[model samples]
Target: MKKILGFAFAIALAFMASGCTMMKMGTAFIKLEPETQEAYAKMMDSIDTYGDPAKAMMIETKINDDVTNDDAVEAIKAITEERNMRVTGDVKMFTKEDAAPDEVKHARIISVCNLTTAKVFLNHSRYYGGFMPCRIMLVEYGNGDRFLITMDLTLAIKGGKPLPPEMLKAALIVKDTMETLIKNGAAGEF
Candidate 1:
């Protein structure tokens, strides 16, 4: 009886240690302005209607003028290559949206990228048991040359759980990257 109890305790401890939300990152949440929130929502809707991702999970986007220029594109490409992400399709961008001004006051574009993580297979049964983060970059050239843009990152947790810290860190990175692009005018292209 004693050995059985000890074994059970050990197994429980291991599971607890392996659970998600154990990874360490920066803060847990990142706040956004009301306008930013609305913009993000609209972008998500577009992704759903246009991209049709099976799990359109994490989304991160930024609105900047020519932000996807050589440098910015290279940065994103590097992340994809380093992470071994399979680009499901070529990056697609929309010239305009439903709510855009009739006169096309600003340059509004939407770009989409897809990536995947490891999958778990058990006796011929395959399952999505890892975290696949999805990112969307939205660039909007507002009036006065003020760029209103943001990135939305979501973790498509399937069969397994995701560490809160890791998710938070990824989110912060997306937000910070958007802020940087806006401040510098799309990789300092301004």
Candidate 2:
């Protein structure tokens, strides 16, 4: 009878401790951007679908059957200019005589940026530099499937404490522009 009473007390203490931990976590979470929860939920959903956490952190669009890699690249460039973003860098990966035949046949990463917005973000936090000059990758698999991929910007936009109003607005514009670049690039649309 004494042992049973002691076990009950232990269980009650565990619950209390866990409850306090939960309360602290909830408080911290509430201090983040309002869309943080939604961003996380979408990331979780992506992980479930792709079975890869890295995949969850990106946005990918399959190129249309008629869209050639060159066409897609051109489209991305055109769209970036039309959207007022500058093409900062264009990297063509794995281009060498010793490249493996079985490896990806084509892979290009185009970096785009808006200087003013980038400066704003940098002034806000140097951490933002890691994400500077957003990349749009064009990759062609061995099976002839092509895709345009970019980092998922949602978490960057809402993962931390709420951004200042102007910063948030700038971030959103960048996010939208990136999504547009990929979607239009995949479709070979300018």
What does candidate 1's lDDT look like per residue over 24-133, in tens digits? Answer: 22122223232444444655777778795432433333434455444454554455444444333334354443333333333433232222222221112243222223
- So what's the TM-score on candidate 1? 0.31
Model 1 error, position 157 (Å): 5.0
Cα miss at 15, model 1 (Å)? 32
Clashes of 1: 20
Cα lDDT computed for each candidate against the true fold: 0.40, 0.88
Off by over 4 Å in 1: 1-70, 96-116, 121-133, 142-190
Q: What TM-score number comes out for model 2? A: 0.82
Q: Candidate 2: where are CA atoms >4 Å away?
A: 1-24, 95-103
Point to the candidate with the largest lDDT.
Answer: 2
Which lDDT tens digits does candidate 2 get at residues 124-163?
Answer: 9999999988998888766677789999998998998999
Q: After superposition, how far is residue 21 of candidate 2 from its true place, in Å?
A: 6.4
lDDT of 1 at 185: 36
